[model samples]
Target chain A: MNKSERLFQLVLLLRSRRTAITAEAIAEAMGVSVRTVYRDVQALVLSGVPVEGEPGVGYMIRPANHLPPLVFTPDELQALLVGNRMVQAFTDQDLAKGARSAELKIRSILTEHLKQHAEQQPYRIPILESDDGLREVHGKLRRACEQRHKVRAIYLDEKQEKSERTIWPLGMIGWTGKWTLLAWCELRHAYRNFRFDRFEALDLLEENFRTTSDISIAHYLQSVIGMRDPG
Target chain B: MNKSERLFQLVLLLRSRRTAITAEAIAEAMGVSVRTVYRDVQALVLSGVPVEGEPGVGYMIRPANHLPPLVFTPDELQALLVGNRMVQAFTDQDLAKGARSAELKIRSILTEHLKQHAEQQPYRIPILESDDGLREVHGKLRRACEQRHKVRAIYLDEKQEKSERTIWPLGMIGWTGKWTLLAWCELRHAYRNFRFDRFEALDLLEENFRTTSDISIAHYLQSVIGMRDPG
Candidate 1:
């Protein structure tokens, strides 16, 4: 390896770990003699890279305030594009707008070639339905989830039975052609999943709820993993 | 920046562009004298990095077979996790499985800290319904889209009128709580969108279809951007 390349790689290796790397380790990584490692490190220090070396301890790089520009491979860019397209198509307007904004910001920082690559992306998202009649409710529930707030609603069951319920909104789950709001039902004194579209009246309550380890989305998903129709 | 950092930055600048960078341009970017740039370029070549140079012309690095490891910030990782979660929740079983496999593979290559961050991803996708009753059809159409194959389907319209149609499956779109297949209908000799769930019977034809620029997902999306209920 060339000295310039080795120097670049040395910075990367140091940046990868929090602990100081030993000189022996550096020598091994650089495929050089111990004496050469010493000389190269001296050269690096003279050039003004902030590498700290202690006599018998080791070497470490102090964290820099500014980071280098982030670069992504073509495949990574493709993944980001496709993922954002899915989010824009499958979620409410708020989240969809966030997705679009994020895409725009990411593109702004990309190189010209990558910017064109992103524009020529083959995947496209088309809104097939004019209205799903649940964007407002989805947004409200999403906010409730984000804020750890309670919600009050009049919901319908599978049997078409209507009832008023107060719940702690945990997370929103999208099944095929359906939105299910996973929450902790205060009435049931246990976790429950309610069909989002089945709400007759919905209101975001002012009261915030404290989440225990047992009441998170992860816990709820774990509880329902092997069950049939958790909702 | 120190000389080592400047040298590293020089390599990055060269890599970002396809055209050879002039010494004057390199000096401008590095805030150094043209003589210093020349000395540095000579040092880089001597150190064995493949930088090709021509006097009074420009310099460029040949494409390297091996690339540095891809690194992502915490926000990028979070975006990936959330996007994969949405895909897992809303798509067919095959796609859901693909999302899971992707998450696993990504985590495997990530740094230990990043792997931990990925595992602690708060977003969750819980399947509320045991069956959407369309996973099989979704998989079929997705494969058809991937292979550029024609599909023969007995479809039901809004009025319950049943008819057979031959379509070149261009792409699959997931709207809120619905999946729509965008295709070119051979019967109509025009682009069309079909409700994925509206298929009474579906079959993938052995024949592959050629996609023209005018009949692509981009064209279909452009044609329906302002239309309501395109499906």
Candidate 2:
């Protein structure tokens, strides 16, 4: 086995054990030399896997180390890769960036022809779906949602007329090909959703939605669930 | 090594070569016994991995297989897992189902303690963000976009005023929390986006956009890119 694969195997062995497992046991179990076991354990500790105990003594993974090193079968990885490509094909800037970074990280683990395959993927995210101001608008709404701030905007209606409005920014949602802002529209005196492309102008206010009333993202979520039909 | 890992390593070795590789060579390459390699190969072929050739003869993977069986490293799996959790937390029914299925498939390959970790995940996707009507609405838009159909709707604007409109449906885009439809509005004679929540009613027409006009999704995409700041 390669060193990376061996190191991964070491991690699995250590994580599987509750009490301290001796280096000799690990070496025997992994079919590697004792010195190699010692060296690999040191590397795991140095890499910060929360493996406790020292060389020649024993190694035990702490229980609080919730996110142990992960591994995905080929099909699982393929699904993720396919999902990322789908996102890049039809989603916003932030998610698109996340997908690219995810792809890069996945590629790093691949080797030889598989690595080459990862580099030269069969599917291509078409150079389609762009809205000049949508990315910027997403940034604005994202910040507003994060900060619990209110926003004011000049919105155009179906009549091709503009209206001034104040809204409590909730969060942004992306459909298959467009972005929409979910918010509490103060002008309409209710929660409303506005298309990202429809916002003629937007700005975040100094006032936060927290001080205004009991309205919140949690409440909004519950409201949606309640809207389901019983029939 | 576990059967799955060993099988994956076997696939990797087989994929690295264009010619048929012997079982003894595969055993030596993966640092496992020849019998173990034979058993793993049987498992792989049984699982429909498309690995070909007999034990005594040699093994080889055909080149025509576009997406060679995928295997995700620890970090790649984690990112995908995190993403799936995020979807269940915030998105609609269709995407939510995709994320759930993705999570299940990823968990299927995990072993021992890691499988337990996958079950009792650290992150809990709180039951927040709901819209019972959204899944149905999303289904409609998805079909509309796929079929390239024209639709008519009674839309309520910010003023709560209703307008009858005929539209050429292009696609749907989701923001952080909602959905929007990108369409060519016949009334205003321009590209328009309608919030799913504000649609008073909708109907799929006898008209298909395929034979209608030359306005392609490519054209709509370019219009957005050209909307960038001129100054």
Candidate 3:
């Protein structure tokens, strides 16, 4: 690699570990002579970079130092790209958008070569099949729950009987190829879980509901699934 | 700030922007002498870092460079602590544990001073309530969904009728007060959403399902919600 490239690698090596890095160690890692390592160290220090310690004692990058430019190896880049794609695959609409936005931000930070590779190899993960209608209702319910709005749904039970109820949505849970809504049912006057598919119709009520203060939807779901009382 | 601190700040400034940075620009930004910027650049380059360009030409840290340590400022740490706590509050048991694990990992990477401060501060965000019998089930369901296992749930509809159905769990969506499950029902041979509370019983079958090859759960939900067929 070129001098600049070697210098960049040195900075990365210093940042990766918690302890001080000796110039000899740097030379060994980079397959360069100790003299070259020494020269590079001098260049970094002269450039107003905050590297601590002497040549013999070992070089340390202080924690307070701002991160140098990020450089991802090919594997790392692929991992990120694939992970972002997975997030987009499973998340709600807004969340999917956020994932795309994050990918763009990363792209903006990448070097030309890395950016080119990223464009050439677009990573995408697939999702499972399910009812489109249920997914839509689920999305709406999630938003309503976040907003603490009341939701009205015509729900069907095991007996194939249907009824309407107003609920304060807290979160959602899935099990056994089924989806459930965890909420405080105004009609039931207690916390309840409603099946999403069983709902004949769903309506977002104009009236807003009180949201839970302490726990998040995930935590609440945990408690319900575990059969534990929040109190 | 000390010289080391100053250098750290300079690196952060340059890393924040992916373009070329000049010594004069660094000096003006940090309100330091250009001579000092020159010294810092020399130091960085001498340390075998990959900073491109010379005194007159602008400098840029190459992308091949390694990232500095994962150091978090006090404010940033506080934000993470708070956010993690919030995640812990609402996530299912497994996820809560995962959150704690991540926090511990973060702590391990911090400097002694930051670690001490983190311990002393003991940042905690409270959660309001927990659901009964949901956490464990949620954990199982999440695993099933991840493993692509078939699930069977004893479900109750609006008429207080109960029935059992086999499903392929797709994903979970959380609303304000409740949790919902999305899946493909074997009985209906279509996608369905179910409520966690309505499940009288849930079972995870030994058979594992495969996620669809192209469509993600989010895309399916969007299309379905928009009254479009996923196929």
Per-residue CA lDDT of model 1 for A1-231, tens digit only, reads 567656755665666555677889889756798888887777767665678989878998776621232244444555556666776565566666766665665565455666776665434566435544576777778778877879999999999999999999887765656668888999998888888778988889889998887887767666655443211
**TM-score ranking of the models:** 1, 2, 3
Model 3: residues with Cα > 4 Å off, grouped in runs: A1-60, A63-231, B1-63, B116-132, B157-161, B213-216, B226-231
For candidate 3, the docking band is incorrect
Separate DockQ for every predicted complex: 0.15, 0.05, 0.05
Model 2 chain B: ten consecutive residues of lowest lDDT? B119-128
**Model 2 lDDT per residue over A123-194, tens place:** 223424454356667667766876778898999977879999999877555443455676788999877878
lDDT of 3 by residue, B29-126 (tens): 66789888888777666655566776566887765433443345543454445434534554456556655665665565555766765553322234
TM for candidate 1 is 0.55
Q: Worst lDDT window (10 residues) for model 3 chain A?
A: A119-128
Worst 10 residues of 2 chain A by lDDT: A119-128
Q: What share of the true interface contacts does each candidate keep?
A: 0.19, 0.04, 0.02
lDDT of 2 by residue, B1-231 (tens): 645455545666676687898888888987888887788776654333456686467987645344333444443454466456445443345555545444643454455555453333222234333555655665566566656678888999889999999988775544434457778899998888788889888888878876233464455655664432110
A119 Cα displacement, candidate 2 (Å): 5.0
